[model samples]
Target: MTTAVSLQNVSKSYGEFKAVDSLSLDITSGCVFGLLGPNGAGKTTTIRMIVNITVPDSGSVYIFGEPASAKLRSKIGYLPEERGLYKKMKVREQLLFLAGLKGVDSKDSANRIVTWAERLKIAEWLDKKTEELSKGMQQKIQFIAALLHEPRLLILDEPFSGLDPVNTSLLMEVIRELSKSGVTIILSTHVMEQVEKLCDEICLINKSRKVLAGRLRDVKSNYGIRKLLIAFDGGDSFLKDDSLSVERFPEHYELNISSVEQAQQILRKAINAGAIIRKFELLEPSLHEIFVNKVTGVDG
Candidate 1:
Protein backbone atom coordinates (compact mmCIF):
# COMPACT_ATOMS: atom_id res chain seq x y z
CA MET A 1 0.00 0.00 0.00
CA THR A 2 1.14 3.51 -0.70
CA THR A 3 1.84 6.06 2.02
CA ALA A 4 -1.01 8.53 1.88
CA VAL A 5 0.42 10.99 4.38
CA SER A 6 3.71 11.24 6.23
CA LEU A 7 5.16 13.60 8.82
CA GLN A 8 8.84 13.75 9.66
CA ASN A 9 9.69 15.45 12.96
CA VAL A 10 6.97 18.02 12.35
CA SER A 11 6.83 20.77 14.93
CA LYS A 12 4.61 23.82 15.24
CA SER A 13 4.73 26.67 17.73
CA TYR A 14 2.44 29.52 18.78
CA GLY A 15 4.47 32.29 20.38
CA GLU A 16 6.00 30.89 23.57
CA PHE A 17 4.20 27.53 23.41
CA LYS A 18 5.00 24.52 21.22
CA ALA A 19 1.76 23.07 19.86
CA VAL A 20 3.32 20.06 18.18
CA ASP A 21 6.75 18.80 19.17
CA SER A 22 8.82 16.60 16.91
CA LEU A 23 5.91 14.46 15.77
CA SER A 24 6.23 11.77 13.09
CA LEU A 25 3.80 9.22 11.67
CA ASP A 26 2.72 7.56 8.43
CA ILE A 27 -0.85 6.99 7.23
CA THR A 28 -1.38 4.30 4.64
CA SER A 29 -3.53 4.97 1.62
CA GLY A 30 -7.12 3.67 1.50
CA CYS A 31 -7.33 3.13 5.24
CA VAL A 32 -9.04 4.93 8.11
CA PHE A 33 -6.36 6.47 10.32
CA GLY A 34 -7.17 7.94 13.72
CA LEU A 35 -5.29 11.00 14.97
CA LEU A 36 -6.09 10.98 18.69
CA GLY A 37 -5.15 13.16 21.63
CA PRO A 38 -6.46 15.03 24.60
CA ASN A 39 -7.54 18.64 24.18
CA GLY A 40 -4.51 20.96 23.61
CA ALA A 41 -2.35 17.99 22.59
CA GLY A 42 -1.75 19.59 19.13
CA LYS A 43 -3.81 17.24 16.99
CA THR A 44 -5.36 20.23 15.25
CA THR A 45 -2.01 21.95 14.64
CA THR A 46 -0.52 18.82 13.10
CA ILE A 47 -3.57 18.52 10.86
CA ARG A 48 -3.25 22.15 9.80
CA MET A 49 0.38 21.64 8.83
CA ILE A 50 -0.55 18.59 6.72
CA VAL A 51 -3.15 20.60 4.80
CA ASN A 52 -0.72 23.56 4.52
CA ILE A 53 -3.15 25.78 6.42
CA THR A 54 -0.41 26.44 8.97
CA VAL A 55 3.24 26.01 8.07
CA PRO A 56 5.28 23.96 10.48
CA ASP A 57 8.18 25.65 12.16
CA SER A 58 10.39 22.65 11.43
CA GLY A 59 10.41 19.31 9.60
CA SER A 60 8.14 18.19 6.77
CA VAL A 61 4.72 16.89 5.74
CA TYR A 62 4.20 14.76 2.68
CA ILE A 63 0.88 14.00 1.00
CA PHE A 64 0.57 11.09 -1.39
CA GLY A 65 4.35 10.70 -1.55
CA GLU A 66 4.95 14.34 -2.56
CA PRO A 67 5.93 17.32 -0.43
CA ALA A 68 2.78 18.98 0.84
CA SER A 69 1.85 21.93 -1.38
CA ALA A 70 -1.06 24.16 -2.27
CA LYS A 71 -1.52 22.37 -5.57
CA LEU A 72 -2.28 19.21 -3.58
CA ARG A 73 -5.07 20.86 -1.64
CA SER A 74 -7.60 19.92 -4.28
CA LYS A 75 -6.91 16.26 -3.60
CA ILE A 76 -7.58 16.74 0.09
CA GLY A 77 -10.86 17.52 1.83
CA TYR A 78 -10.69 19.11 5.26
CA LEU A 79 -13.59 19.36 7.76
CA PRO A 80 -12.03 21.58 10.37
CA GLU A 81 -12.73 21.28 14.11
CA GLU A 82 -13.94 24.82 13.99
CA ARG A 83 -16.91 24.63 11.66
CA GLY A 84 -17.21 27.39 9.07
CA LEU A 85 -20.05 28.29 6.72
CA TYR A 86 -21.74 31.42 5.43
CA LYS A 87 -24.59 31.39 7.95
CA LYS A 88 -26.99 33.47 5.85
CA MET A 89 -26.47 31.46 2.66
CA LYS A 90 -28.87 28.74 1.60
CA VAL A 91 -27.49 25.21 1.96
CA ARG A 92 -27.42 24.45 -1.74
CA GLU A 93 -25.85 27.79 -2.66
CA GLN A 94 -23.23 27.48 0.11
CA LEU A 95 -22.21 24.01 -1.06
CA LEU A 96 -22.00 25.15 -4.65
CA PHE A 97 -19.80 28.09 -3.74
CA LEU A 98 -17.44 26.00 -1.64
CA ALA A 99 -17.16 23.37 -4.32
CA GLY A 100 -16.45 26.07 -6.91
CA LEU A 101 -13.54 27.22 -4.79
CA LYS A 102 -12.14 23.74 -5.31
CA GLY A 103 -12.60 24.18 -9.05
CA VAL A 104 -15.66 21.96 -9.24
CA ASP A 105 -18.05 22.97 -12.06
CA SER A 106 -21.16 24.72 -10.80
CA LYS A 107 -23.54 22.28 -12.52
CA ASP A 108 -21.63 19.22 -11.35
CA SER A 109 -21.44 20.65 -7.84
CA ALA A 110 -25.20 21.21 -7.84
CA ASN A 111 -25.89 17.63 -8.86
CA ARG A 112 -23.51 16.21 -6.26
CA ILE A 113 -24.87 18.47 -3.56
CA VAL A 114 -28.42 17.26 -4.16
CA THR A 115 -27.29 13.64 -4.26
CA TRP A 116 -25.36 13.94 -1.00
CA ALA A 117 -28.05 15.94 0.78
CA GLU A 118 -30.62 13.31 -0.12
CA ARG A 119 -28.35 10.53 1.03
CA LEU A 120 -27.67 12.35 4.29
CA LYS A 121 -31.43 12.92 4.73
CA ILE A 122 -31.16 16.67 4.38
CA ALA A 123 -32.54 17.10 0.88
CA GLU A 124 -35.39 19.33 2.03
CA TRP A 125 -32.96 21.65 3.79
CA LEU A 126 -31.06 22.56 0.63
CA ASP A 127 -32.94 25.83 0.33
CA LYS A 128 -32.88 26.54 4.06
CA LYS A 129 -30.48 29.16 5.35
CA THR A 130 -27.46 27.67 7.14
CA GLU A 131 -28.22 29.44 10.41
CA GLU A 132 -31.77 28.13 10.44
CA LEU A 133 -30.61 24.56 10.78
CA SER A 134 -29.78 22.95 14.09
CA LYS A 135 -26.14 22.38 14.97
CA GLY A 136 -26.31 18.74 13.90
CA MET A 137 -27.97 19.70 10.64
CA GLN A 138 -25.35 22.39 10.04
CA GLN A 139 -22.66 19.80 10.67
CA LYS A 140 -24.20 17.63 8.00
CA ILE A 141 -24.06 20.56 5.61
CA GLN A 142 -20.37 21.09 6.38
CA PHE A 143 -19.77 17.40 5.80
CA ILE A 144 -21.49 17.53 2.45
CA ALA A 145 -19.43 20.55 1.50
CA ALA A 146 -16.27 18.64 2.30
CA LEU A 147 -17.35 15.75 0.08
CA LEU A 148 -18.42 17.91 -2.86
CA HIS A 149 -14.96 17.79 -4.44
CA GLU A 150 -14.63 14.01 -4.12
CA PRO A 151 -11.24 14.38 -2.47
CA ARG A 152 -8.88 11.42 -2.36
CA LEU A 153 -7.82 12.29 1.17
CA LEU A 154 -10.57 13.26 3.60
CA ILE A 155 -9.47 14.78 6.87
CA LEU A 156 -12.32 14.92 9.42
CA ASP A 157 -11.75 16.76 12.67
CA GLU A 158 -14.49 15.99 15.21
CA PRO A 159 -16.88 15.21 12.41
CA PHE A 160 -19.37 13.75 14.88
CA SER A 161 -19.10 16.53 17.44
CA GLY A 162 -22.61 17.93 17.31
CA LEU A 163 -24.44 14.92 15.95
CA ASP A 164 -27.01 12.82 17.73
CA PRO A 165 -26.65 9.03 17.76
CA VAL A 166 -28.71 8.59 14.61
CA ASN A 167 -26.75 11.20 12.71
CA THR A 168 -23.49 9.91 14.05
CA SER A 169 -24.28 6.43 12.77
CA LEU A 170 -25.34 7.88 9.44
CA LEU A 171 -21.99 9.67 9.10
CA MET A 172 -20.03 6.61 10.16
CA GLU A 173 -21.75 4.59 7.46
CA VAL A 174 -20.76 7.19 4.88
CA ILE A 175 -17.15 7.16 6.09
CA ARG A 176 -17.01 3.39 5.73
CA GLU A 177 -18.39 3.67 2.23
CA LEU A 178 -15.77 6.27 1.31
CA SER A 179 -12.97 4.14 2.73
CA LYS A 180 -14.22 1.17 0.74
CA SER A 181 -14.04 3.23 -2.45
CA GLY A 182 -10.30 3.82 -1.84
CA VAL A 183 -10.39 7.26 -0.21
CA THR A 184 -7.79 7.64 2.51
CA ILE A 185 -9.43 9.07 5.63
CA ILE A 186 -7.77 10.80 8.55
CA LEU A 187 -10.23 10.85 11.47
CA SER A 188 -9.31 13.19 14.31
CA THR A 189 -11.55 12.98 17.35
CA HIS A 190 -11.55 12.39 21.09
CA VAL A 191 -14.09 9.59 20.79
CA MET A 192 -12.11 6.39 21.34
CA GLU A 193 -15.09 4.09 20.70
CA GLN A 194 -15.57 5.49 17.24
CA VAL A 195 -11.85 5.14 16.54
CA GLU A 196 -11.88 1.55 17.83
CA LYS A 197 -14.73 0.82 15.45
CA LEU A 198 -13.56 2.70 12.35
CA CYS A 199 -9.79 3.07 12.36
CA ASP A 200 -7.39 0.59 10.85
CA GLU A 201 -4.50 2.36 12.54
CA ILE A 202 -4.04 5.09 15.14
CA CYS A 203 -1.52 7.59 16.47
CA LEU A 204 -2.08 8.85 19.99
CA ILE A 205 -0.39 12.04 21.09
CA ASN A 206 -0.11 13.76 24.44
CA LYS A 207 1.73 16.85 25.60
CA SER A 208 2.78 17.54 21.98
CA ARG A 209 4.54 14.17 21.66
CA LYS A 210 3.77 10.84 20.05
CA VAL A 211 2.79 8.44 22.81
CA LEU A 212 1.53 5.52 20.75
CA ALA A 213 1.35 4.70 17.03
CA GLY A 214 0.56 1.41 15.29
CA ARG A 215 -2.09 -0.82 13.76
CA LEU A 216 -5.12 -0.94 16.08
CA ARG A 217 -4.93 -4.70 16.62
CA ASP A 218 -1.19 -4.67 17.21
CA VAL A 219 -1.44 -1.85 19.72
CA LYS A 220 -4.12 -3.70 21.68
CA SER A 221 -2.27 -7.01 21.45
CA ASN A 222 0.89 -5.39 22.76
CA TYR A 223 -1.04 -4.28 25.81
CA GLY A 224 -2.19 -7.89 26.33
CA ILE A 225 -5.38 -9.23 27.99
CA ARG A 226 -4.82 -8.55 31.65
CA LYS A 227 -8.28 -7.31 32.47
CA LEU A 228 -11.18 -9.50 33.53
CA LEU A 229 -14.79 -8.40 33.38
CA ILE A 230 -17.21 -10.09 35.74
CA ALA A 231 -20.77 -9.31 36.69
CA PHE A 232 -22.52 -10.96 39.57
CA ASP A 233 -25.33 -10.74 42.07
CA GLY A 234 -25.38 -11.54 45.81
CA GLY A 235 -22.37 -11.05 48.05
CA ASP A 236 -19.70 -8.50 47.12
CA SER A 237 -17.05 -10.10 49.32
CA PHE A 238 -14.92 -11.26 46.36
CA LEU A 239 -14.09 -7.61 45.57
CA LYS A 240 -12.60 -7.25 49.04
CA ASP A 241 -9.58 -9.30 48.04
CA ASP A 242 -6.49 -7.09 48.46
CA SER A 243 -4.63 -8.76 45.58
CA LEU A 244 -7.07 -7.42 43.03
CA SER A 245 -7.16 -3.88 41.66
CA VAL A 246 -10.67 -3.39 40.38
CA GLU A 247 -12.72 -0.75 38.67
CA ARG A 248 -16.39 -0.88 39.37
CA PHE A 249 -18.81 -0.15 36.60
CA PRO A 250 -22.54 0.09 37.10
CA GLU A 251 -23.23 -3.40 35.83
CA HIS A 252 -19.88 -5.13 36.13
CA TYR A 253 -16.48 -5.12 37.76
CA GLU A 254 -13.23 -4.98 35.80
CA LEU A 255 -10.33 -6.57 37.64
CA ASN A 256 -6.70 -6.33 36.68
CA ILE A 257 -5.31 -9.81 37.04
CA SER A 258 -1.91 -11.01 35.84
CA SER A 259 -2.69 -14.61 34.93
CA VAL A 260 -5.47 -16.97 33.97
CA GLU A 261 -4.91 -18.77 37.24
CA GLN A 262 -5.53 -15.56 39.10
CA ALA A 263 -8.71 -14.96 37.12
CA GLN A 264 -9.94 -18.46 37.91
CA GLN A 265 -9.09 -17.92 41.55
CA ILE A 266 -11.19 -14.78 41.57
CA LEU A 267 -14.13 -16.60 40.03
CA ARG A 268 -13.83 -19.38 42.58
CA LYS A 269 -13.72 -16.86 45.38
CA ALA A 270 -16.76 -15.09 44.02
CA ILE A 271 -18.63 -18.38 43.88
CA ASN A 272 -17.50 -19.34 47.38
CA ALA A 273 -18.71 -16.02 48.66
CA GLY A 274 -22.24 -16.89 47.49
CA ALA A 275 -22.08 -14.53 44.56
CA ILE A 276 -24.06 -15.67 41.53
CA ILE A 277 -21.94 -14.74 38.55
CA ARG A 278 -24.00 -13.38 35.66
CA LYS A 279 -21.10 -12.85 33.31
CA PHE A 280 -17.38 -13.47 33.39
CA GLU A 281 -14.80 -12.90 30.70
CA LEU A 282 -11.16 -12.13 30.31
CA LEU A 283 -10.52 -9.37 27.81
CA GLU A 284 -7.90 -7.01 26.59
CA PRO A 285 -8.17 -3.45 27.81
CA SER A 286 -10.59 -1.39 25.74
CA LEU A 287 -9.42 1.61 23.70
CA HIS A 288 -11.11 3.98 26.18
CA GLU A 289 -9.29 2.40 29.12
CA ILE A 290 -6.00 2.49 27.27
CA PHE A 291 -6.54 6.09 26.21
CA VAL A 292 -7.13 7.16 29.80
CA ASN A 293 -4.10 5.24 30.98
CA LYS A 294 -1.79 6.58 28.29
CA VAL A 295 -2.86 10.19 28.67
CA THR A 296 -2.57 10.05 32.44
CA GLY A 297 0.87 8.32 32.38
CA VAL A 298 -0.57 5.25 34.08
CA ASP A 299 0.01 2.77 31.24
CA GLY A 300 3.36 1.70 32.67
Candidate 2:
Protein backbone atom coordinates (compact mmCIF):
# COMPACT_ATOMS: atom_id res chain seq x y z
CA MET A 1 0.00 0.00 0.00
CA THR A 2 1.21 3.48 -0.89
CA THR A 3 1.68 5.90 2.00
CA ALA A 4 0.86 9.56 1.58
CA VAL A 5 2.73 10.60 4.71
CA SER A 6 4.85 8.82 7.34
CA LEU A 7 6.35 10.05 10.58
CA GLN A 8 9.08 8.10 12.38
CA ASN A 9 9.89 9.07 15.97
CA VAL A 10 8.94 12.67 15.06
CA SER A 11 9.18 15.26 17.81
CA LYS A 12 9.51 19.00 18.41
CA SER A 13 10.43 21.18 21.33
CA TYR A 14 10.68 24.82 22.39
CA GLY A 15 13.38 25.33 24.99
CA GLU A 16 12.43 22.79 27.71
CA PHE A 17 8.86 22.01 26.59
CA LYS A 18 8.47 19.04 24.30
CA ALA A 19 5.48 19.78 22.05
CA VAL A 20 5.30 16.63 19.96
CA ASP A 21 6.75 13.43 21.37
CA SER A 22 8.28 10.58 19.42
CA LEU A 23 5.18 10.09 17.28
CA SER A 24 5.14 7.50 14.51
CA LEU A 25 2.16 7.41 12.14
CA ASP A 26 1.15 6.69 8.57
CA ILE A 27 -1.56 8.15 6.32
CA THR A 28 -2.34 5.95 3.38
CA SER A 29 -2.84 7.43 -0.08
CA GLY A 30 -6.42 8.15 -1.21
CA CYS A 31 -7.89 8.14 2.28
CA VAL A 32 -9.35 10.71 4.64
CA PHE A 33 -7.16 10.41 7.73
CA GLY A 34 -8.44 12.08 10.88
CA LEU A 35 -5.83 13.52 13.24
CA LEU A 36 -7.63 14.08 16.54
CA GLY A 37 -6.59 15.51 19.87
CA PRO A 38 -7.66 18.10 22.38
CA ASN A 39 -6.39 21.67 22.29
CA GLY A 40 -2.67 22.16 23.09
CA ALA A 41 -2.07 18.54 22.13
CA GLY A 42 0.63 19.35 19.55
CA LYS A 43 -1.64 18.95 16.51
CA THR A 44 -0.63 22.28 15.02
CA THR A 45 3.03 21.53 15.66
CA THR A 46 2.83 18.22 13.84
CA ILE A 47 1.08 19.88 10.90
CA ARG A 48 3.74 22.59 10.79
CA MET A 49 6.52 20.03 10.58
CA ILE A 50 4.70 18.19 7.81
CA VAL A 51 4.31 21.45 5.89
CA ASN A 52 7.91 22.42 6.65
CA ILE A 53 6.84 25.56 8.49
CA THR A 54 9.12 24.55 11.36
CA VAL A 55 12.09 22.21 11.51
CA PRO A 56 11.57 19.28 13.84
CA ASP A 57 13.96 19.13 16.76
CA SER A 58 14.30 15.39 16.10
CA GLY A 59 13.15 12.52 13.86
CA SER A 60 12.01 12.59 10.21
CA VAL A 61 8.89 12.73 8.02
CA TYR A 62 8.47 11.24 4.58
CA ILE A 63 5.94 12.75 2.19
CA PHE A 64 5.01 10.64 -0.83
CA GLY A 65 8.16 8.50 -0.38
CA GLU A 66 10.57 11.47 -0.16
CA PRO A 67 11.81 13.72 2.59
CA ALA A 68 9.49 16.67 3.13
CA SER A 69 11.46 19.01 0.89
CA ALA A 70 10.51 22.22 -0.92
CA LYS A 71 9.23 20.38 -3.98
CA LEU A 72 6.91 18.21 -1.89
CA ARG A 73 5.50 21.32 -0.24
CA SER A 74 3.67 22.31 -3.42
CA LYS A 75 1.82 19.01 -3.41
CA ILE A 76 0.28 19.94 -0.05
CA GLY A 77 -2.58 22.41 0.46
CA TYR A 78 -2.77 23.53 4.06
CA LEU A 79 -5.69 25.41 5.60
CA PRO A 80 -4.44 26.44 8.99
CA GLU A 81 -6.53 27.07 12.12
CA GLU A 82 -5.56 30.70 11.82
CA ARG A 83 -6.92 31.90 8.50
CA GLY A 84 -4.93 34.38 6.44
CA LEU A 85 -5.90 36.43 3.41
CA TYR A 86 -5.01 39.85 2.06
CA LYS A 87 -8.10 41.80 3.11
CA LYS A 88 -7.77 44.28 0.27
CA MET A 89 -7.40 41.77 -2.53
CA LYS A 90 -10.32 40.58 -4.64
CA VAL A 91 -11.36 36.96 -4.20
CA ARG A 92 -10.12 35.76 -7.56
CA GLU A 93 -6.98 37.87 -7.34
CA GLN A 94 -5.95 36.35 -3.99
CA LEU A 95 -6.56 32.85 -5.31
CA LEU A 96 -4.63 33.57 -8.47
CA PHE A 97 -1.71 34.89 -6.45
CA LEU A 98 -1.66 31.80 -4.25
CA ALA A 99 -1.90 29.50 -7.28
CA GLY A 100 0.96 31.36 -8.95
CA LEU A 101 3.08 30.81 -5.86
CA LYS A 102 2.44 27.09 -6.29
CA GLY A 103 3.59 27.24 -9.95
CA VAL A 104 0.05 27.13 -11.32
CA ASP A 105 -0.59 28.96 -14.60
CA SER A 106 -2.89 31.95 -14.57
CA LYS A 107 -5.27 30.54 -17.22
CA ASP A 108 -5.63 27.14 -15.55
CA SER A 109 -5.99 28.68 -12.13
CA ALA A 110 -8.70 30.98 -13.47
CA ASN A 111 -10.49 28.01 -14.98
CA ARG A 112 -10.31 26.01 -11.76
CA ILE A 113 -11.38 29.01 -9.67
CA VAL A 114 -14.38 29.66 -11.90
CA THR A 115 -15.37 26.02 -11.80
CA TRP A 116 -15.11 25.82 -8.03
CA ALA A 117 -16.81 29.14 -7.47
CA GLU A 118 -19.68 28.27 -9.77
CA ARG A 119 -20.13 24.85 -8.21
CA LEU A 120 -20.12 26.35 -4.74
CA LYS A 121 -22.61 29.04 -5.93
CA ILE A 122 -20.16 31.87 -5.26
CA ALA A 123 -19.61 33.01 -8.85
CA GLU A 124 -21.30 36.32 -8.02
CA TRP A 125 -18.64 37.20 -5.43
CA LEU A 126 -15.48 36.61 -7.50
CA ASP A 127 -15.02 40.32 -8.16
CA LYS A 128 -15.72 41.32 -4.55
CA LYS A 129 -12.95 42.15 -2.08
CA THR A 130 -12.10 39.39 0.37
CA GLU A 131 -13.10 41.54 3.36
CA GLU A 132 -16.53 42.32 1.91
CA LEU A 133 -17.71 38.71 2.04
CA SER A 134 -19.38 37.13 5.06
CA LYS A 135 -17.42 34.66 7.15
CA GLY A 136 -19.02 31.67 5.43
CA MET A 137 -18.40 33.12 2.00
CA GLN A 138 -14.84 33.95 2.90
CA GLN A 139 -14.38 30.40 4.14
CA LYS A 140 -15.68 29.07 0.84
CA ILE A 141 -13.26 31.30 -1.06
CA GLN A 142 -10.36 30.23 1.12
CA PHE A 143 -11.29 26.58 0.58
CA ILE A 144 -11.32 27.16 -3.16
CA ALA A 145 -7.95 28.78 -2.90
CA ALA A 146 -6.62 25.65 -1.17
CA LEU A 147 -7.89 23.44 -3.99
CA LEU A 148 -6.94 25.79 -6.81
CA HIS A 149 -3.41 24.39 -7.07
CA GLU A 150 -4.76 20.81 -7.14
CA PRO A 151 -2.54 19.65 -4.31
CA ARG A 152 -2.28 15.90 -3.90
CA LEU A 153 -2.72 16.15 -0.11
CA LEU A 154 -4.91 18.69 1.71
CA ILE A 155 -4.31 19.50 5.35
CA LEU A 156 -7.41 21.08 6.89
CA ASP A 157 -7.40 22.20 10.54
CA GLU A 158 -10.86 22.79 12.00
CA PRO A 159 -12.26 22.81 8.47
CA PHE A 160 -15.81 23.23 9.70
CA SER A 161 -15.18 26.19 11.94
CA GLY A 162 -17.37 29.34 11.66
CA LEU A 163 -19.82 27.77 9.23
CA ASP A 164 -23.54 27.24 9.59
CA PRO A 165 -24.80 23.67 9.29
CA VAL A 166 -25.79 24.12 5.64
CA ASN A 167 -22.36 25.36 4.63
CA THR A 168 -20.73 22.74 6.81
CA SER A 169 -22.56 20.05 4.88
CA LEU A 170 -21.56 21.75 1.64
CA LEU A 171 -17.89 21.71 2.58
CA MET A 172 -18.23 18.10 3.71
CA GLU A 173 -19.52 17.24 0.24
CA VAL A 174 -16.55 19.00 -1.36
CA ILE A 175 -14.08 17.23 0.93
CA ARG A 176 -15.67 13.90 0.06
CA GLU A 177 -15.44 14.74 -3.63
CA LEU A 178 -11.78 15.68 -3.31
CA SER A 179 -10.99 12.40 -1.57
CA LYS A 180 -12.95 10.40 -4.14
CA SER A 181 -10.85 11.94 -6.92
CA GLY A 182 -7.66 10.59 -5.29
CA VAL A 183 -6.53 13.41 -2.99
CA THR A 184 -5.35 12.31 0.44
CA ILE A 185 -6.62 14.47 3.30
CA ILE A 186 -5.43 14.93 6.85
CA LEU A 187 -8.43 16.36 8.69
CA SER A 188 -7.52 17.63 12.14
CA THR A 189 -10.45 18.65 14.27
CA HIS A 190 -12.01 18.30 17.72
CA VAL A 191 -15.31 17.28 16.15
CA MET A 192 -15.56 13.53 16.75
CA GLU A 193 -18.85 13.17 14.87
CA GLN A 194 -17.26 14.42 11.68
CA VAL A 195 -14.32 12.13 12.16
CA GLU A 196 -16.59 9.15 12.77
CA LYS A 197 -18.52 9.77 9.58
CA LEU A 198 -15.72 10.86 7.23
CA CYS A 199 -12.43 9.25 8.21
CA ASP A 200 -11.32 5.81 7.05
CA GLU A 201 -8.44 5.74 9.55
CA ILE A 202 -7.54 7.85 12.54
CA CYS A 203 -4.76 8.71 14.99
CA LEU A 204 -5.63 10.03 18.43
CA ILE A 205 -2.90 12.09 20.05
CA ASN A 206 -2.74 13.42 23.58
CA LYS A 207 -0.03 15.42 25.35
CA SER A 208 2.09 15.13 22.17
CA ARG A 209 1.88 11.34 22.24
CA LYS A 210 -0.13 8.83 20.24
CA VAL A 211 -2.79 7.24 22.45
CA LEU A 212 -4.67 5.49 19.68
CA ALA A 213 -4.23 4.80 15.96
CA GLY A 214 -5.87 2.38 13.56
CA ARG A 215 -8.79 1.85 11.16
CA LEU A 216 -11.85 3.64 12.56
CA ARG A 217 -14.12 0.61 12.97
CA ASP A 218 -11.39 -1.53 14.44
CA VAL A 219 -10.42 1.17 16.90
CA LYS A 220 -14.03 1.52 18.05
CA SER A 221 -14.40 -2.21 18.55
CA ASN A 222 -11.09 -2.29 20.36
CA TYR A 223 -12.16 0.30 22.93
CA GLY A 224 -15.90 -0.28 22.87
CA ILE A 225 -18.12 -1.62 25.63
CA ARG A 226 -20.63 -4.26 24.72
CA LYS A 227 -24.06 -2.89 25.47
CA LEU A 228 -27.64 -2.54 24.27
CA LEU A 229 -30.39 0.05 24.64
CA ILE A 230 -33.97 -1.12 24.79
CA ALA A 231 -37.38 0.49 25.24
CA PHE A 232 -40.24 -1.71 26.24
CA ASP A 233 -43.55 -1.53 28.05
CA GLY A 234 -42.74 -3.22 31.35
CA GLY A 235 -41.79 -2.52 34.94
CA ASP A 236 -38.11 -1.76 35.73
CA SER A 237 -37.81 -5.21 37.28
CA PHE A 238 -37.89 -6.72 33.79
CA LEU A 239 -34.30 -5.53 33.29
CA LYS A 240 -33.03 -7.31 36.42
CA ASP A 241 -30.53 -9.82 35.13
CA ASP A 242 -27.27 -11.10 36.59
CA SER A 243 -25.51 -10.93 33.24
CA LEU A 244 -26.25 -7.21 32.61
CA SER A 245 -26.12 -3.86 34.33
CA VAL A 246 -28.97 -1.44 33.54
CA GLU A 247 -29.06 2.31 33.36
CA ARG A 248 -32.32 4.16 32.95
CA PHE A 249 -33.05 6.97 30.51
CA PRO A 250 -36.40 8.78 30.44
CA GLU A 251 -37.67 6.85 27.47
CA HIS A 252 -35.64 3.66 27.65
CA TYR A 253 -33.18 1.62 29.69
CA GLU A 254 -29.61 0.81 28.66
CA LEU A 255 -28.33 -2.68 29.37
CA ASN A 256 -24.59 -3.17 29.54
CA ILE A 257 -24.14 -6.71 28.34
CA SER A 258 -21.08 -8.81 28.91
CA SER A 259 -21.43 -10.44 25.51
CA VAL A 260 -23.48 -10.32 22.29
CA GLU A 261 -25.00 -13.58 23.34
CA GLN A 262 -26.05 -11.97 26.60
CA ALA A 263 -27.86 -9.22 24.74
CA GLN A 264 -29.84 -11.82 22.86
CA GLN A 265 -30.59 -13.59 26.12
CA ILE A 266 -31.72 -10.32 27.66
CA LEU A 267 -34.15 -9.79 24.77
CA ARG A 268 -35.58 -13.24 25.33
CA LYS A 269 -35.97 -12.55 29.03
CA ALA A 270 -37.70 -9.23 28.30
CA ILE A 271 -40.13 -10.98 25.95
CA ASN A 272 -40.82 -13.72 28.48
CA ALA A 273 -41.43 -11.10 31.17
CA GLY A 274 -44.34 -9.65 29.13
CA ALA A 275 -42.52 -6.53 27.95
CA ILE A 276 -43.80 -4.82 24.82
CA ILE A 277 -40.60 -3.85 23.05
CA ARG A 278 -40.52 -0.46 21.32
CA LYS A 279 -36.87 0.12 20.47
CA PHE A 280 -33.97 -2.25 20.71
CA GLU A 281 -30.49 -1.44 19.49
CA LEU A 282 -27.05 -2.89 19.97
CA LEU A 283 -24.98 -0.01 21.29
CA GLU A 284 -21.70 0.74 19.61
CA PRO A 285 -19.41 3.11 21.43
CA SER A 286 -19.09 6.43 19.60
CA LEU A 287 -15.84 8.23 18.90
CA HIS A 288 -16.57 10.48 21.86
CA GLU A 289 -16.82 7.47 24.18
CA ILE A 290 -13.58 5.92 22.97
CA PHE A 291 -11.83 9.29 23.11
CA VAL A 292 -12.89 9.94 26.67
CA ASN A 293 -11.79 6.47 27.72
CA LYS A 294 -8.32 6.72 26.15
CA VAL A 295 -7.51 10.27 27.20
CA THR A 296 -8.65 9.66 30.75
CA GLY A 297 -6.56 6.47 31.04
CA VAL A 298 -9.61 4.45 32.07
CA ASP A 299 -9.28 1.05 30.43
CA GLY A 300 -11.06 -0.87 33.20
Number of clashes in every candidate structure?
0, 0
Any runs in candidate 2 off by more than 4 Å, and if so which?
238-245, 268-274
User: lDDT of model 1 at residue 278?
Assistant: 97
Model 1: lDDT equals 0.92
Report the lDDT tens digits of candidate 1 across residue range 1-300. 899999999998999999999999999999999999999999999999989999999999999999999999999999999987898998888899999999999999999998999999999999989889998999999999889999999999999997999999999999999999999999999999999999999999999999999999999878744799999999787688677798989999988977889988888888889998899998987898888988998765
Query: What does candidate 2 score on TM?
Result: 0.93
Q: How far is candidate 1 from the true structure (C-alpha RMSD, Å)?
A: 2.2
lDDT of each: 0.92, 0.89
TM-scores for all predictions: 0.92, 0.93
Q: Cα lDDT of model 2 overall? A: 0.89
Candidate 2 per-residue C-alpha lDDT over 58-147 given as tens digits, one digit per residue, 9 for 90 to 100: 899999999988888789999998897899999989999989998999999999999999988899999999999998898888888888
* Poorest 10 consecutive residues by lDDT, candidate 1: 235-244
Clashing pairs in 2: none
Poorest stretch of ten by lDDT in candidate 2: 235-244
